[model samples]
Target: MTSAASKTFVRRLGVLLGAAGLAAPLTVAMGATAQAATSACTAGTGPYQAKAERFLGRTVDGKQSAADCRAIRDFQLDHGISPAIGYAGPVTWAVMDLVSQQRAAGDNPNAAGRCPVNKGRIACVDLTRQLTWIQDGKRLKSGPVPIRSGRDGYETRTGLKKIYWRSIDHWSTLYEVRMPYSQFFDGGQAFHSIDGSVWSAPGSHGCVNMRRADARSYWSLLKNGDDVYVYGRKPGT
Candidate 1:
């Protein structure tokens, strides 16, 4: 269970960052409305929501912002990951720890090579194929996997990113989603694993989802600030 203090921390962080909406818990029927509200702010409208503004300022190829209500609107059009209040609760943290433990044991996803820790290695994944690979010394070492893309057609974006944010045991028990950046773009899509084979299908709303096994494997190889190359499908399609 999360200490009451931790819950407060998460809530404060959300409000200070203009991400208080994210802190709101999701519901089966109202979840869509909540996420859609994220993009309601215009470039200069409302109180200076620093987190929202910062997210909105970033552009994918000069387009898309974490605060784009249109993106939120798009999500409602098809429904997507609900950043419900408990989504980033204590359970998420625990799972991340487990994944870290397994990876620290020297398990290699592709048996290809070490994940690149250099300035030039290509770190990327293919959601269509459910594979996350690292650029070894000279080649791409692939890890077996399955991912959930956007069910609403807001596909996982294709781009270059550095590990930006991370949270353990997000959402529910044993589920952790590693975010390369803030969930600003398309409401901050994530790379996470769900409980069943649902991930193998187009299960996620827009996040790059993986199976529990594959997610665990990735947790071992990746770290914050690392670069990742996403191929096949644009993020938050």
Candidate 2:
């Protein structure tokens, strides 16, 4: 991006959200009820849950509707935070600002005991944490972003691989789904953007799903032959 564009992007990101709720990018099922929403937002305080709910345009009772959780995932994706698996994790919690939490507490620059991959400018995918980030050595370049990988039977592959190809606008032949900003590393699995609703559940056939914004950022930072280290085990793996 040009300097002017970068500045414009930052400025856009800096824009504070108004009192109005965030528009749902994808359609949310009307299945969410007050009780169900309340239970979903049970991760924390009423105020915080309310924040997430209101942000998602759900009931202000701090209930987490299916749509609310999915909307949070969308927010995470847009901000480049990862395991786009929808849950109010540290990053999400902090972003919601409903509670007082340390944002830097769990950051594993070294990736610690998980699948620690020390490579120059690598995209580290921690399936265990459901997070992905780009790093140059120990320096984080892009994110420790949340991501959603393949589900139980269709778990994402672990170990080292290299980016072999990239498609800015690609379509999955088998699944016939739109995979925007795809960066293929493993055979069929790549880092790509998925629909907002996809993050509400443990899903994906066998790929890492990022937010379209994050995928675009990854496209800008990564290239063919770039080291792609996917490690740790997906939940329940």
Candidate 3:
């Protein structure tokens, strides 16, 4: 399979989890409570047993609701951490610690260079820890920012692509673009921050979501005719 296709499969199979409270991106369905709604933030867990049972394609009963599962996922995503599918692993814990440090720092050190491609610069989305910047010939730091991505079918398109144009302080995204520029692909997709809720649940209509602070930063730093790249979850559980 192609690398992108492979990555998608891996992400699906892996069943990566997020923190228990902070939301990022990723639709979650536990036992019965499946619905999409933004609400007050607090903190929490999904039914591990239910998740495992579902993995086997078997039905199971539980106290965990779809909201619970989504909340947990959102927590992880917003925090730049990943959850363990079955048992807690070292990597999961490490990601938690790293995410905590990053959140505390409140600055994206990764943005200190050029964009991954030779054309533009790089920026880090503090919310999801996903990087987006201009990629022309190399990577550079456009600015420090925050972002969230897809929960399901409309997962953010990653890898190398050129920025079609720019939209400063846009209503949807701080910056917008047309990527891949391939056949039958809609070029209106954009990269910006979230304006509604902080929960990282699966949301957005095919755009890369970010925090307003980060989005504004990107708006002020990046120029038109740059490149952008984003990296996120992959398949294989």
Error of 2 at 103 (Å): 5.3
Q: Which candidate number would show the highest TM-score if scored against the true structure?
A: 2
Q: Would you list the rank order by lDDT, best first?
A: 2, 1, 3
Reference-based TM-score, model 3? 0.42
What tens digits encode model 1's per-residue C-alpha lDDT throughout 1-237?
346765566556656646444433222223555456443533222232332223334333323333444443332232232332222223222222323333443434434333334555445565434456566555545453435566556666666676666655655223253332222222356666665443222356566666666666666666776676566542223
Predicted candidate 2 versus true structure: per-residue lDDT over 1-237, tens digit per residue: 666875565446435322223222222222443235333321223235665665555667655556666676667666545544355555465444411121242465444734343567789887766678887877778876667789889999988899999999999889888999999999999999986643345567789998778888999999999998888776544
lDDT of 3: 0.43
- For model 3, how does the per-residue alpha-carbon lDDT over 102-209 read when each residue is reduced to its tens digit? 455333344444224343353323224433332224433443333445546766565555456665534423335322211111265566656553233444555666
Between candidates 1 and 2, the TM-score winner: 2
Query: How well does each candidate superpose onto the true structure, as a TM-score?
Result: 0.40, 0.57, 0.42
lDDT of 1 at 19: 47
RMSD of 2: 14.2
Model 2, residue 9: displacement in angstroms? 47
